[model samples]
Target: MDGAEREVATLLEQLQGLTSNAEQVEGFRRVQEIVQHRDPSGAERRVLRGALPLLGQIVQLRNAALVTSILQLVAQEASSASSTVTTASAETLDVAAALSAGLYEVCHTVLLLSHSTEKNVVLALQLALGSLHSTFEVALRAETVENGLDTEPRRAWDAATRCLEAAAGIVAIVPEATGSDSNRSAMVWLRAWKFVESGVMLLSTAQDSSVYRDPARSNIQPNTWSLDRLSAGTQAILPKTKLEEFGVMLLKAMCEAVTSKSDNRLPLQRRELSVAVNSLSLLASLRPQHMPNILPKLTALSTVVATPGTEDPVVQKSLTANLVKLLSHPSAQVFADEVTDILIAVGASQRAFSAISKSKEQRRKYTSAPTEASLRRARIGKRTATQSITERVENANAHAKRRRVNLSESSATPIPAEKHWQLKKVRSECVILGSGETQDSKHRAKNNQHWCQFLMK
Candidate 1:
């Protein structure tokens, strides 16, 4: 074997060692640095692919450090290939094809580990989320750029598409992984949302006609294309429908989290609401046909707006403004009638608020019980804090009597104090008659003596 081949072999050994035993972490880091910066020769790249099989085996060990190293290796490979593909088109680097071979299992393993009850596994998966997104971004970039180039990189595009589909499939398994842990489900869903968001943002930038690049580097110049222009220009390669699908997936995941809450209100935080609203707004702008489908969720956000717990009024107003802005657009004029109803239902304007309040008054008659129940619970809670002194004393006495009765119920007989006292009186009378006793004793001493002990019963 050549020197490059020997290096690849040694790196693969390190990766294997790292997986079997975590002590080899430094070895894995060396491999990462070589792939990322040293720019390994083609012979070494081919040999590095050999580690793909070992990824599945090591993931079973569920060691965060080792698993992360394995994923980092894959990420570095994809990053290296990405740099090459954009710069040196003359020499094709099919990293996607090589990585896609093992991408599905890696993603699946991470998905499983993400929901682990163990803190270490969950944290490791969180750390790995960035690597997963990087991998997906490369696939998306390849797919988007396939049409822009004169000769289509069909293999890379196909591999990239498969990876994306696999990622989507992994999202479907998130619920199963979380089981009954709502917090875990929310976390998994957030990660999935972010993954989908990266794709959607890329697609959006590509689709925008207004985007322009510094034209110093064209196809001949290759990788010199400015990021903004390259991203925008790549828009021509991806279908609008495919992009919308990703956006919809993100929205679906977010909606799942919101709906999973006991009260079914959108999260009150600015960041969470902003993301949901902005995403919906972008989707509406891109796919007007889906406006009808998106309106219900937008309107249903009223509960979030009306929620008393949130301190910020601007959050609600901001959501309202976005909806109004979208509906009022000239292109959206066709949706005017539907828009009017949704606006009124969401109480976005004075007329809308009036209509809603009137209808709410009518509905309040039937729905009064829920409000009443809440008020009743609140009253019961307060009564404990402000109980009257008489009531408190009565309760204390009742409790003491109940405790005494319970103690008596457990015994075979009650104390015979009354009978013993009567016998004591008779004995004292006999003693008084038989012997002249002092008529005077300390009144306190007489009173302190137990009449029952004097009876000698």
Candidate 2:
């Protein structure tokens, strides 16, 4: 090796030996100097190439001082204005892969150090996780339509999956990360879920074959990539059965989180609950039968809704609507009547009844009763409103049935013809209301219309 190469290698070895944080920082500064010089010499290039992997090793060791030093080098290297520095490839993969690897290493380090009793180590780990999340966000934005469709997409998927799996592993090892005291962990998990949600949204959009065709020609911006592709890639590395098992494990974790009686209100737990609800919603869309499996957890969530004066109206609405939809399913009829009763009780409060009564009283006091002109006017108005509502309800049901049929036909390959037919039957059994001709039918029709709209929306 040349003199510069020898010098870099020696510095790297020496950096590894530095026991003190100050010494490690100094060593990293020196390495940054050599890398910044843009020396094309063999030694400098080799050392620059070697830095990432070696840093990765340091991260695995859970050496806070070493990880910080490595991050400093990366930040410095990243900040250089020279085109050579900016364009300088890692001799690893592109910037995406390098960033992903760095994130993976950081996650591993954080998981390892999360158990440390030392406050500083934990704090450092949290900082590193935040840095890693920011880096991934940058990488995620840099993805283009071409890159999203090519090998880069797969790498992106793998990287994200790795980060999520690592986070899950960390939480498993250190349950305290999801506990009330660890705001950092809560933030980390929230960031991860945001990424995952973005991924799922992208996948849902990309499932349209038209999106992939002429990826560059389309106006569709590549904001996110497919989770199915990510899951498939992970399944290839892991096993299909194992992937299914992992999904079940996540569901179990969610169930525990929902049911756990702890008073500790961690933001991570809330984030996890949101993730779990979205996941359950996705699974219900994919496999309606699985809705029953998650019903108990949904029921637990409903109790939260049942709690009065919660500031989260959105969460309450989502939980109640989801429960109602599940109950409306044919397989869930055992709880359908119960859900209907709850909806009635919640929807028709004394306030609403009082408002209706006050309006009737005002009408009676202001206008003469039993007048033919007023009665005819009211009849015409009611008929028009009833007709409009009937049309809307019919249109919505038609749209929903069409969606169910399309989804069923699309999966005809995996689903037995008998089962597919059964699904259609269950879907048909879901009642759709028409315009009412009688007072009792009108009330029942309005209730059915209201419930259907709530569930469909």
Candidate 3:
């Protein structure tokens, strides 16, 4: 081996000895120095790339200090790469690809721990997930421009999808295991919502197909990639097949989770429902090739909710609301409006059926301001003097205050005025009787009461 290659190998070995946080930070400090060198060798570049997965190992052990170090390194490297105005080179491309791959591995490993019962472990995993998601995204954009249709970018996306799957699993399992009423369950469900939201956001990139297309054929031969295999290789049949499969599986699972009841419990929480619907809406917006089949599956689930004796009124109402949202969706226009009747049959209120129409009308009226006073009349009733919203709020507050005063008065103790007066009069008579000196004193006291004495005379 060459002297430079030997030196690079030795440096990497020293990096492995970085057992302490201080040592790791110092090691990365030197690595950064090497990166900033005017002409870094391929071996040095490899060392930098190799260090990324090592950080993943530290993260696996759930070491807070090491994890922080790794995150800072990622941020530093990413910021430096993005902010630089230099021309791209083959070595730079390699570093970017390696960084992307390592970050993906880290995210995938962390996500596998998402279902942990330990709060700390779960929290760390979530942090790792967020870091990996953002880091991988930036790397993908940078690398895709340099190395068009590269497998590394596709692999990065797959890692993100896998992370989402792990997150969703955590969401489903925690509530089921903990009886849905525990504090832990609530927190885990919250994490689950975050994961779902992230997953949807990640999937949103598909809206721009040019940015997220399958890898093109390489000179190596008839080249293609699968979800399981994102790199350019001699492939027999299809590309992105597995990715499509994963998307389908994810959508189906989410739909079922949102709609199906858990024995006696309600279907997923309301938040989960909203997140799931949002994810599905995004997926639908992407106009996936398999959406026709997916839409039918979604509609079938809603149909069962419409049938009698499946869920209680509250569950039915929630499911119906989601279904209505789906039907009124801009993406779902291709699907028939049959869901309205299904909703009504399932005991959806009349308001629920007319909700979409009303919303459309409201939007239309807002867009086109009416000049005619008659057209501007209130739909619900006659306008009451056209008060400003602020004025209305003030009036409402005053009314509420009056109601509060009335309520306080109604709950207050009686004043007992009559009893008080009678008590005072009795006390005065008692005092008169107690103070009397004798019959002569009594006659003098009676003479002092002039009106009564005159009447007696």
Candidate 4:
């Protein structure tokens, strides 16, 4: 037999053995050697290229640990200098393709496992989904930037689109399992939604940057392309229509899970529901202009939050934050009364105040205190002692007012600008009202004064 034929035979035998024995580490090592061997024209190299399909099959087995290892190797190779060579390029592309296929398989497997009676498998699937989402993102981004294209690389974008499509499908699969039986799956879906949200945000950010808008910029950063170009390529795969469908489905599933009163699913459902609410909140915040599209989804979620006897502290907090932000949307006033009622019912106002107060304290503690010696050093000029006193008093009053405002929610009490200078002087010496009340309060007070003086001077 020819050398190439012999090498192919040997590699195939190793793959079969590895799979039969489930020797994941050994199998991965063998794949690595095949891809990395220096001999360009050698039989082993040719055989290795042919073995891509087999590697894909192994990933399809739903072994997340193995999939993770393979993905890491692929990412590492893709990032290396060797990946740019002509011969190495084909191998890199093949590896990327294989990994993408395997990722889809893994996602599918997770969907199936989500239905398992075993808790471990469900939890494992949730964790696996998270890892797979991140890996897919890295691979997708790498492929796009691999070679500077005037437009996004269609192949890479298509692959990413498929991955997200698969994820959406997985989320849809467990709609009926909404109560406890599917709580874990719901959490996985929530995370997957975040992955999609971030991807869109990145795309949007890229579109807004000069790199995408001006072709005259000689060195266009990789992945920077006109939104028009992106929209065209992504139209079929992640069109607005598809996004709306997915968004609606996600909202429905989360609401069902969260509102489920079944004893078995209550805890898990509540946890997943909290995550879903947070994810929705983030999406709303990042894409406020898309409120018309998002409002209905929020409405559905709000219904669950508003349900009597379902006032979970965590969920309430999440819902309140989302609603407060939603108030900024033009259509928010339509639901303002209901949203406000829920916020108050859940004590979100008090919670928000407490959070603000704590944040002020934290800011105060971490900031450096202005020493009297530093103040004295600043009085180098023939400025009158009264002038210094006036400045110090202004700094102290300003600092005190800020501490009060930050600690209190009332927006009506605006401290005079001159008072800030007085507050600054006393900020280092005496504790401002509400200052040093808590660790967070002290830090916050100190930070406020530090920034105020820094800016004023």
Expressed as tens digits, the lDDT of each residue in 1-457 for candidate 3 is: 4443345446556766657766766765565555445224543355455455556655554344445555555545544543331354544544554554565566556556533334543453465455544444344344435434456545555555666687667655535444433324656656655665444334322422212211111111110111322235532222345545555565556555655553344455545554555455444534344345445645555555445654445544654665565554444545635666666666765745565564344221111223456445653255455556656889999999998897687557453676556545544443253553787757655654543323222
Deviation in Å, model 3, residue 111 alpha carbon: 2.2
Per-residue error (Å), model 3, residue 76:
4.5
Task: Check candidate 1 and list the clashing pairs.
Answer: none
- TM-score, structure 1 vs. true: 0.49
Return the top candidate by lDDT: 3
Cα lDDT tens digits for candidate 4, 173-196:
443345664534455556555545
Q: Give lDDT: candidate 4, residue 327.
A: 56
Backbone atom clashes (below 3 Å) for every candidate? 0, 1, 0, 30
What TM-score should be assigned to candidate 3?
0.51
Rank ordering of all candidates by lDDT, starting from the highest: 3, 1, 4, 2
Query: Could you give candidate 2's per-residue lDDT for residues 1-457 as a string of tens digits?
Result: 5565567677877877767767776776776777667446432344455565666555544355655556555544432211232233333224444444444454445444544323333443443444433343333333422222224323533554555455444333213454544524554444434433333233232333222211111222332332333333323232345444544554444444445353333222444565656555544433333445566666656555456543245665665555554443334454554555555665733433333333233121111124677667777677877788998899999999999997677656475676556555544554555664666766665665555444332
| Among all candidates shown, the one with the greatest TM-score | 3
At residue 310, candidate 4 shows an lDDT of: 50
Candidate 1 lDDT over 1-457, as tens digits, reads 4554466557755656543454656666665565555545552365456556655665556456666666656655655554544443323434543553354445455655543334333333443444443443444455544434422334333434444443444344433333554424545444554554444444333323112111111112221211233333444334445655655664454444333143534443455556656665555544344455555566556445656654346666766666665554334555555556656655566744443333223221111123567767777666753475667899999999998897676454544787657765644544222244454543333543544344442
* Per-residue lDDT value at 97 in model 4: 41
Name the 10 consecutive residues with the lowest summed lDDT in model 2: 210-219
Steric clash pairs (candidate 2): 5-43
Runs off by more than 4 Å, candidate 1: 1-22, 26-44, 87-91, 96-108, 114-189, 201-273, 286-290, 303-315, 334-457
